[model samples]
Structures are given as C-alpha cells and as structure tokens.
Target: MMNNATVFTEFSLSGLKDITTKNRVILFSLTLLCYSVILLVNVALIMTIILDEKLHKPMYIFLCNLCINSLYGTAAFYPKFLFDILSDTHVISYIGCLLQVFIIYSYASCDFSVLTVMAYDRYVAICRPLEYHSVMTRHRVAFLVGFSRLVPLLCQAIVVTMTSKLTLCGSQIEKLYCDNWSILKLSCNSTTANNIVGFIVIFFYLGHNLFTMCSYVQLVKCALQSREGRKKFLQTCVPHLLCLLNATVALLFDLMYARYGSASVTQSVKNFMAVQFLMIPPILNPVVYGLKLTQVRYSLLNLCRCNKQVKGLN
Candidate 1:
C-alpha cells in the first residue's frame, strides 16, 4: 500500500465547490472588476506620488509605499484566483502555496508596519511642528520606509520557512487560498515552534497597533487644544485612524476565519472572512487618501487636467 502521509506535490483549494458555470462567470467578472479598480487607484496614487515633487514629504512617501504594497499583495492573490475561477482544479503547487502564504502574510504585516510609521510621522508633524522638517528629512523617511518593509518581510520569511518544514499529511485546504495557518493544519508534525513564532510575530505587530492608537489618542488630545491643530488632525490624522480601523477589522476577520470558522458557516461568509483583508483595504486606502488628503487629491486633479491639455494639443 502507498503511504497516505507522503509529501504532497500540490494542494487543492475547496472554497468554490458546488458553484455553477453561470455563478462562476459572475464571480470572475466581479473579481476582475475589483482587481482592476485596485490596480487603477493604487497605481494612480503611486504614480501621482512619484511624479509630484511636492508630495515627496514623509507622510505621502509612506502613503505611496502603502499603495505599492497593496498592489504587491493583491497581485499575489487575484491573478491566481481569477485563473482558478476559469479552471476545474483549484489547486496550487507546494512552492506556489508557500510563496502565496509569504506574500499575503507579509503584505498584511507590512500594512501595520507602514501605519505605525505613519503614526510616528503624524505625531512629529502635529505634536512638534517646529521640528518637523529637521526630524523627517529624506534620509530619515527612507530609513523608516525601509524599516517598515524589511521587518514584516523578514518576519514572514521566518514564518514561511518554519511552515515549509512541516510534514503535511493532507493536502486539501479548507479555504480559497493558501495561508500559513491552513497549511499548519495539514502538518502531522508538532507545530509548537511555528505557533510560538507566529504568536511572537502577532504580538509584535499588535504592539505596533497599540503604539499607533496611543499616538492617535495623544494626537486627538493635542488637536483639542486649538482650532488649527484640530483642522490639521481632521485633515491628516483622521484618515490614518480610519485606515487603522479598516486594517484591524480585516485582520481580525481573517484571524477568526482561520481559527474559528467552521463548515457549519455558509461558504459566502467564509469566503468574505478569508478575503476581507485582500478585498476592502486595498481599495479603501487609496480612495480615502485620494479623496481626503488635500495634496493627493489636488495632485490627482492636476494630473487629469494635464492629460486633457496634452490630448487637446494632439
């Protein structure tokens, strides 16, 4: 008899079961629409920031990095998801599964890290206006941005590395995409080390959230001191808070789905729970920034106007 627990070459994803061709077509169209919006807005914001010299400040720099990461994260999931929708098999190669886990998790981790850095940037600008330029120099901003991207990636690298060593007895993932927790569930070996490290990474980033929220609280308190501070907070700090809340809720949903979601729950809810992090934040962040942030909004408008003028000249 063949070994049932032998190393599997591929894993089947099981979320799209029992769907008809019509429904699959509808799902593909909607996913493509959403992914297109994600690309358009994120790329628009990223290009706006890159092209506009005046938007090169620390805050916008961080925001540009956020959009860039959104693109990176969504690219990992959406392309494969669309392909799976068109095919009979919802399976991923072992290496591809690990790579997806790394990109998706690291993307989530990178969001928090970027937000934490943005909070610090807001703190300096609002709490210490006089020292803003001196403190948030280009060099400092580059280092902070580098810090935000590097830490989560390295941390996720460790997690993915740990996950790759597991002796998986089964290969069917209960969710739509490959994730570390789901992969961990397949492992016949003990996951104590993986759990410890995963917890450490979770708490470490949760600390980032705590620091960011406390910073927001202090910012609000400072904003209440005067009218001008209040305006600045409304303009800048509020959007960051909204984004934080969005990210927190999405992350929490995924965490719950990964741990507590059951077959008893409807698949629609399960799909939403698994992918809220991927779906909502990428769209919301750029929209919020583009609409709310004066510089970005004006820059986008100017970009559009310039494109029109060039077209007219042609």
Candidate 2:
C-alpha cells in the first residue's frame, strides 16, 4: 500500500484564488517582510545568547531554542510562498508536500516543547531561586533541549512514515500550504488509525506539556507572595500564555474543522484565521519578548547601532 502510494508521481494544490490580486500582492509583500524580520530577529536572539556567556543559564538556553524553532517554522513555508507568488505555480510534487509538512511540524512541535520546558525553567528560577543553579545544571539543560527536539522528531517521523503509505487521490488540499489534517482529508484509505494516533500524540504531548506549564504557573504564583515578585511573575507569564492560547485555538479549530465541513465562505474566513495562527505566533513572539524583556530591547538597540556602524564602514 505504501509503495503504491509513493509510486503516484504528482499531486495538485488548490491555489490561493479567493484572495484578490491586490490582496495577493499585499500578502506577498507583507509575508516577505515578516519572514525576513523573523529570520534576522531570531538569528540575532540565538547569536546574542551564544556570544554572551553571562546568558548561558537555563532561561536563555530555552529562549535560544525557541528562537531557532520559530525561525524554522517561518522559513519552512514562507520562501515557497514567495516563489509561488512570483512564479505563478500552484502545483507541488508529492515529495515536496511531504517535506513541507515534515519541516513545519518539526519546527512547530519543537517550539511548543521548548515553551513547555521554558516554563519549567522559569518556574525553577522564580519559584525556587535558591536551588535554581543546582536544579538546572548544564547537563540537565542539555537534556531538556534534547528531549524537546526528540518528541517532535519522533512524532514527525511517525506521521511522515504513516502518511507516505496512504494514497491521496480525488482531493487536493485548499490551503496556501499543506497542513496535516488537510492532507489527511485527501487520503483514499481509512483515516481511523491516523486520527487515533494523532489524537493520542496531541493528548500525550500537548496535553501533558501544557499541564506542566500550568502547574509551573501556579507554583510561580505561590512563590510570588511579595508585591514585586507577583508583578514580575505576571509579566513573564503573559506573553507565553498568549502564545499558548493562540496555539490551542488553532489546534482545536483544525481538529473540529476536519470533522465538520464549513461553508465556502466560512472556510475562507477560517483560512484567514488559520494563517494568523501559524504566521502571527512567530511574528508576535519577537514582539512579545521584546516588549517583555529589557535585555531583548537593549540587544535590539545595540544591533541597530552595530548595523549603522557596519554600513558606514562599507
């Protein structure tokens, strides 16, 4: 079954047609700008942590991982989108589609995993500041990072392997990019196994990780009895909570949407929201962190200065 499915050479993509030409041009420009900023900002975040050994603690380490995942997520599809806009091609090869799904899932899932780990790190730092160093030692930090990548890594492998066996005939995906549920909808084979595995994975992975984060939140609150500590705790959790809410909504919407079909107009509106869930998070992340963290703002200022100096030298 898998071998035969792989033998089918090509797959058609339902192009972005509902959007007007003006909208397309605007979207193209905005997406390009957003991706460029996402890349540069995330790379800067990573480099800042790497260069500054003072920031080598667990929090910064997790932040670096988060930045990398955000970069990967935005980069996975943005370039292809730009190419499609320029070349006017709506079709993608089956292999290419699978690759897209794999890369996007890897980045996105890893991002969530890293966020969960980061919440724990913050909890340790704030809630148990006395033992923060002892608890989050270098080896332990490395383990968390490795574990974050490992979960998503294994999940993506399973999804791709399973999906490769299923035949996609008669239906083409209608999104700007190929998403998991959307692609699964096209499978000629029964999706019972896929749905079950996907649900189990989400429950085990997202559910548990999110629960851990929530537990840390409560702990952080308990530790923050002092007025200043309570304020700082709220400040730290706000951005993460917002991102988490956005992600949760997007996931639920995708799952439910797959089960119940929407009207064409409704689907279009949902598509717009879907893009928001995917694109907004990465873009908003830097903004959120920038607004929340003093260090990130200072780093941005320094980066601007360095760029100005380099341009003058050039």
Q: Pick the candidate with the highest TM-score.
A: 1
Return the TM-score for candidate 2, rounded to 2 decimals: 0.87
Write the residue-wise lDDT of candidate 2 on 94-173 in tens digits: 78888888888777778778878877876776777789889999999999999998889899879878887887754477
lDDT of 1 by residue, 85-199 (tens): 8998899999999999999999999999999999999999888889999999989999999999999999999999989988888999988899999999888888999999999
Candidate 2, superposed: residue stretches over 4 Å from native: 1-7, 19-22, 258-261, 266-268, 306-314
Query: Which stretches of candidate 1 lie above 4 Å from their native place?
Result: 1-4
Maximum-lDDT candidate: 1
- Give lDDT per model, in order: 0.93, 0.73
lDDT of 2 at 7: 49
What TM-score, computed on C-alpha atoms, does each candidate reach? 0.98, 0.87
